[model samples]
Target: MAKAFASQGDLTEKEISFTEIGEGLYAFTAEGDPNSGVIIGDDSVMIVEAQATPRLARKVIDCVRSVTDKPISHVVLTHYHAVRVLGASAFGASQVVMSEKARSMVVERGQEDWDSEFDRFPRLFQGHEEIPGLTWPTTTFEGRMSIYLGNRRVDLMQPGRAHTAGDIVVYVPDQNVMFTGDIVEYHSACYCGDGHFHDWPRTLEAIRRFDLDAIAPGRGDALVGRDMVNAALDLTGDFIRSTYRPAARVALRGGSLKDAWDAVRAECDPKFSDYAIYEHCLPFNVARAYDEARDIDTPRIWTAQRDKDMWEALQG
Candidate 1:
């Protein structure tokens, strides 16, 4: 490859912030790295989105320890991305939960996603030796499931396919706060390599209808009010549309992948260049958007070699 992916050069450590969004709801964010959500129930706690490795997961555990001594009994994965689910062992939760489709993806492409992610961003996988193996959900649900942390109710529902075919959001009705996984991002580039560009907006509407008071987004700071929450949603929607529109146009015109990349950059760079992981995500986003525009519904799995091939080709 002529050069490494932008994330390959992102070795600098990010400062972690644990912010409370509601009475017992918190968001654990690390700059633009994947964010984790903490929900304190009447008895135990529920975690959303485990980090990449056990070592990274410990950072979230540490934050939990600082706030409450309640044991983490449930770990709800929002999707099947390796960065979000491979650290379940660290939580030692009694139940690790995921949507049925997500569990299937883990079985189908879990290893490939892990390898491709390691190639792209090594910092997130600091404790590669401690990963044990692919993380699997002990509990799986079809569309929706409600788990009670004593009196507190946590609803895990698959709103629609957006970030992935099995993306789910953890909603706390009592607090009016939702832990949206990669379905929503703030100021950070959405990794569309395994995303549904067309369905994402509709899924966002499903979430917006909840009129959440706050949101713990996938990769940015905790949104604590309606204005901030709306801003994050708007930014996420704009980013997706800007990237896909130009790429779709290129694909419709029967242009090359490189041409699609160029068109997407011309449209997105001006608005999203400063967002975290922007450069790293652009090529993959364009590739998927072009594929979707070409009428491919299911996203093709990404492998380490495929990552390099796509990166190298776009370097032209």
Candidate 2:
């Protein structure tokens, strides 16, 4: 397993690092890129969050092979982001599982998301053509599902909507370990383009009920030990609060989107400027925050054109 880093070129072409986070559990992370999790069960393996392309996924396969010979039976999507689910076919898993809501989201906005994300972060989708098309779940569950990997149990539950309408967490109770997709990040700026800001903190509180000793976050390094785990959660919570609060305040004051964006940057940059992806996420985060604060519960779809327009409007 390798350490995650920040890549500057095509994301699909970037190198990925797979690190063991617990007994038979691994975190596949790229340099400040989206992450995937692997759980090697007694008889088979479960991969959570597929990368963006088959070519990139092969790198994850190679890492998994280095650790075990078990077949990968399932690929679980924590949500329906193109960067996270598009590379699923590469795993050859018998079943691709996702929340029912996630499947709906894929059908509704997957193509638009794919185009938007690829345009925004070209470095994360290095081999863009290698994608077999949008990944769909062969199996979908509502609320929660408990999967048995031989003697081990993996609980896939949607605590609440935070990062997206279909966010989920993979809980390994026996190991006291959890894989929180983009719901919680460590030293990484969270992208909130499709988030429910008001519901996000409550979602975090739901996640805290797990009493996890270790956490494989969506981005950044794996958290080990309770102290580090708390620190990661706290940092993530603070980041979300600091980002959304000011943006919401400005929006409520009838300020323009640019004003809200500038207000948020003024409040958050001093504290979180050094966090990974801070510059990358701020514009999108502010946009979503403004929408949510204005009583838009559902995030507006982000087409490639809309993405560029928003970036130029907020950044330029």
Candidate 3:
């Protein structure tokens, strides 16, 4: 636990890197932090997932500015996580887009989630005071929506529920690149506190249907080449399965929460110990896995108090 806090205070924010994944498509990845994608169309730019705060998003905006001067007309939220969507205001996009389910989740539990996440990962929320409020999508869709940036077409599709009920992937067809939020983490720990463990594998399958040459995951390095893309997706799927199945099995056998937590830790930590945030996410992942395994469909809402209590129970 002390080792986990060792890097917790290392909050030296770095410059955002704009990597050209494909033609006019770039992935803006910070140093092992949450990532945002950029799609440059003929006329304007579309940003996927805002950073934790306006100040952080400005760094992403600065990266975009270096590549193109196009106005960011749209900000697409992959899900409603505070680290991913709270920076929407900084983009100043005319329309902030999200799935209908995500928008509803925000309306229902956004404040609690914001508080919970801020406490859990203080480094990500460097400028929490500047957050305007809960990020509400100005426009939302049910299944899928297509928007053309001049001739470049960006497809927003809810392949299935993985990270959250409203996880959406931004697909650029011409480039065969997909910007998958937390659904596929490349060498980064998958945060599964609000995830759908059973449906996550199916969601990964849906993501594989696309002929993706490159994948910009929610965190870590941008995956290039089909092999790396497939590997990332497979590794993420494996992590989810390894975390949930063993915990669920223990819970079904009437094991205590601590028992299930130990089971999942034994199974997952060895393989994923070297991944970023592995220690931080394991406790929450085990808790959620135990709940879902016991037929708790809707994940229990995590408030700030609940976060502290759970952390003490599991990690203390």
TM-score of each: 0.98, 0.95, 0.96
lDDT of 2 at 156: 93
Query: Number of the top candidate by lDDT?
Result: 1
Model 2 TM-score, all chains together: 0.95
**Candidate 2 Cα RMSD (Å):** 4.1
What are the runs in model 3 whose C-alpha is more than 4 Å off? 1-15
Across residues 125-170, which tens digit of lDDT does each residue of candidate 2 receive?
8788878788999999988899999999999999999999999999
Which prediction has the highest TM-score against the true structure? 1
Error of 3 at 197 (Å): 0.9
| Per-residue accuracy of model 3 over 1-316 as CA lDDT, tens digit each | 4333323555675556779999888898876789999999999999999989998899889889989999999999999998898888999899999999999999889999998888767778877889999999889999999999999999999999999998999999988999999999988899999999999999999989886899999998899999999899889999999999899999999998899989998998889988987887888899999999988989889898987778777767
Q: Arrange candidates by lDDT, highest first: which order?
A: 1, 3, 2
Q: How many residue pairs clash in each candidate?
A: 0, 11, 0
Comparing candidate 1 with candidate 3, which one achieves the higher lDDT? 1
Cα lDDT, all candidates: 0.93, 0.87, 0.89
* Better candidate number, 2 or 3, judged by lDDT: 3
